[model samples]
Target: MPASAPLPKSARRPRPATDYDVVIIGAGSAGLSAALVLGRCLRRVLVCDGGAPRNEPSPAVWGFFTRDGVQPSELLRLGLEQLAAYPSVEVCSLRATEITASDQCFTIVADTEASRTRSITARKVLLATGVEDELPPLDGMREFWGHGVLHCPYCHGWEVRDRALAVYGRGKGVTGLALLVSRWSKNVVVCTDGPGGLTNKARQRLQKQGIAVREEPIERLEGTEKQGLQHVLFKNGDKLVREALFVHPHQHQHTNLAEQLGCRLNSKGAVWTDKKQQTSVPGLYAAGDTTAGMQQAILAAAEGSLAAIMINEKITKEECV
Candidate 1:
């Protein structure tokens, strides 16, 4: 971002010895986008490339405008490359382990790849840490992750369209999920692993929609990585060859920083923020999957950009005062 007109020396606040203007945890789409914006505004920024993103195992990211079908790693590489233009921004592979707040600034303790610990301080903090998916505990589930088993139909549905697909879940949510998956494939089955916990009308609706319900308990999934998932074995000794499976797994924050800092969380456990993305804690902000139920790369990036701009504005007002 182009810098605004320089403030008069009388009105300007001298730079303190604080390590950075902002310390951003988790350099995913959100952190990277925030760093880009803050760097352009000439604010010192540090983005921690903690580890692989939540979608690291995903083959490709979809529905992102102008970058559809791009590999997840490739998109991150491009983001990092473009951020190189901003001298005020720094990206490091550090795992932030602890955080504490004081009157002067917030302190952060991070561990390097070599396991060396480093302490840093910043005037502001942004938590871009995403969420973690709890995959169902079933044999071959890990092996077929991102390939045979998936989430987010808009993200991976087109690839498996017209193929034999199964929706894994039970109760109310599974009913709607199965109906949604039916849009991509004609052969859709709901594997409830026992009683489906559906109302009579709900089951009738599913049947009318041409979606089948499997009440047999699942034994395990059988598949090869090279050819993708081939079969789902049931405890009743019946087996069905399913090309792909979809499930909306339970999710939780990838890191506990938000809770550690006393940021109020919403009912879904995501850090609650105002429209400007500032968390309940002053000078602290959250963006991306850390702040909302809806998860998407493009949406996370937009949140990051908005947070950065809001942070800059807040800092400017402080300086003027």
Candidate 2:
């Protein structure tokens, strides 16, 4: 038995059996949506959620229709509740550790909360496992992440629109993102954290817009999680006052399951998928943030729906043959 107590009987959902038609490796918007479609199609589907959502820190998930401004945890709860109506679907709060394929079947080994491991076999697999953002290692950065510090402007831009915004990061991507952040806030500064590696053309363009460029390395972020970001301190003993900071973090898949299964990765490190959301490996599929760079709940759900549809079609055609 695990050291922690199990969920109350009322809170526990039935677990899926050993063999399944499909095993979805994430329970976020994309995985849950895919599971719903596959379940309604009468396919035996299991959704394994590791219980860690990238958007958990965000106050609300934006840009999603009907559920706009909804809390990420609440949105996931509602999705899980809706999925309960489908008898063919089951959810396991476990993390997939390994995946192996052989002779038209795939075996998934996952670490369970019950202090034991479980293995299940499925005919097909969906890699909805999203990416983890690699934010810069700066004091107080993690404390204010997703609140005062954010990535997607469309998702969190409206709330901080017109606020004193600063772009904080390095590399060429930061230059473009800083320019983009200018749209949400007229008063913007680009804190390159030293040199910024920006081309002369980019610097001239930013200068034309009257955006202050601070090329000093950030020493620390001064603020409490409650008070939000106050200043970006520099090694030169100067500080830039800002309300929010935008970053374009380099992200990687949350797990190595895709790589273990031999799925090809694109240049940006996201899982490469075709128009149908099928990965390079046959019988394997991917969706959501893992498949593209533009990370949004609605877009991920749409990709999940598309992946489910294609998977259903693929399975049906296979059966017919």
Candidate 3:
């Protein structure tokens, strides 16, 4: 057979499918951190986000060393702008719909504005897709959340210190949250909302600590729009006015992309990953609230950086081989 030259321009390798070195889903704290690291390493990266952050309802983000009280949106905007300096990193404001692996690379389909669908291929995938807090079905709870009714003491306890605080016994988190919030307020009330699994010993401990345990089922949250939460109304027509309220919301992973990719999940439904943030599925990794039980911005960012470094190293090694 005669030797044949390459085909015309239209019959090439299709430009290798525009495979990126890494594709990070969710541009929140974790995703942004990972992108920053990978960009600094001069890696080809793409970050797809829906712009709906987990803490969007929260007025301010706490516990970040120098950025305490920073608005979540402000922080994200600054982070996005900073990442803009890296020419290799691209940030697309889109929602990732599906991810599938093809040989050694992965393809990600995202839903952008105007309902347009876009796809990108990447050698590795980092899922920083955070979790969502399923709030209680109490009236006015959503309006006061992150203002006076809050979840994390580490995030909002200081502001309400020494005030009359109420904790809702919704799940296994009530006891722990009550104890922790006790440090912030001398007058703390734990509303069991009727019978719970708490033992007598636990009740005694709470009483000894000057924490009041109310067994009445809560009816609704009473508060004003401007002043935030004011009190809790009980089914018995009684009300206990409070300066602040604490409740651990039932949280669930916002996306099942990790599970769909065969990544192991923890007992809490969070994506299970190793120290390097690598999930069970090779080339697939997860970090931040997707894997962490204690969802904090700083911790998520740290995990993101760790995952980025691991990903960069893996890509470097593979390229060398």
Candidate 4:
């Protein structure tokens, strides 16, 4: 025999439609990580991303082992590249409009950048869609987000360590956040912006920690064009010459998908996930900042991996029967 010919397409077995085993919404670290594991397990996976990530404004993603200080965009790009190696995974740059569940499947409606609408169905849905930080309403505060204004001390503390850092936020939790920020800088001031309803014991605790409390209302954040944040001005004609500010902002889901799917949220407003990262609804899962208080890239990726393993196991068990 001289040579052997490959089988023709019609002669080969028919292929199934593009139905997916799992559909992942949000292609951030969590979503991409989940897709990677699912793809490696030989599961048909689809990842849909809206292009706007919570860390888009941040210059770097910190606290991630082996990839600390990496730019958020670059990290996600590398993750997608790794996922591309798996033949079972497909990534789409589209915004998910709505998701509806019926029986054991879900239909996702999404809109593309070209204004085209597409819908896909999957056996399971994983919402790696993260949370949106709602910054307090103070003039010029929006201008310094991810720069001079930050939320997590672990994320931005080292850079501003030993600098004049001001902790500005409302509610009782802010007192604790200020205390945590104090670890990074001895010169820390807590500006409640108003009567924070802090107990006398709480004030004593802060005082014991050498953190000064400013109860005046914040009028605006003053920043220079070159130096970023310069001071926090108060309505009472007082100002704190702070170099950086930390805040404990209220956060909510970036999209209504969780609420629409009736996923139970904890008291902290995060999606309630079990040890397996499975949501209240069977066949549905969640991970990342939307499901936890300790938001970090590495932790979110770990959660995504956990969810993927559980999802694959569920699918495998179902197929075995």
Q: Can you tell me which runs of candidate 3 are displaced by over 4 Å?
A: 1-18, 170-172
TM-score of each: 0.92, 0.92, 0.93, 0.92
lDDT of 2 by residue, 88-203 (tens): 99998889999998767789999999968999999889999999999888887888899989888999888999999998876567778878888888889988877788888888
Model 4: pairs clashing at backbone N, Cα or C within 3 Å: none
Return the clash pairs for model 2, or none.
Answer: none
- Using lDDT, rank the candidates from best to worst: 1, 4, 2, 3
lDDT of 4 at 21: 93
Candidate 2 lDDT at 294 equals: 78
User: How well does candidate 1 match the true structure, expressed as C-alpha RMSD?
Assistant: 5.1
Alpha-carbon lDDT, every model: 0.89, 0.88, 0.87, 0.89
lDDT of 4 by residue, 1-321 (tens): 234876765675543343899999989989999999999999999999888789888879999999989999999989988887999999998899899987768989999989999999999999999999999889877889988899889888998999999998756787889889999999999888898888888889899999998989889999985798999999988878999999878899899998998989999789999999999988889999979758988889999999999999998986654
Whole-model lDDT, model 3: 0.87
Query: For all candidates, what are the clash counts?
Result: 0, 0, 0, 0
Q: Estimate the lDDT of model 4.
A: 0.89
Off by over 4 Å in 1: 1-16
Off by over 4 Å in 2: 1-18
lDDT of 3 by residue, 1-321 (tens): 235975665664442445688999989999999999999999999998877788888999999978999999998988999998999999888788888886678988889988999888999999999998898877778888888789889999888899999998743578778989999888999987888678777878788889888888888889887888888999999999898898888778888788677778878788988888999889998989999567789889999999999999998886654
Judge candidate 4 at residue 184 and give its lDDT: 96
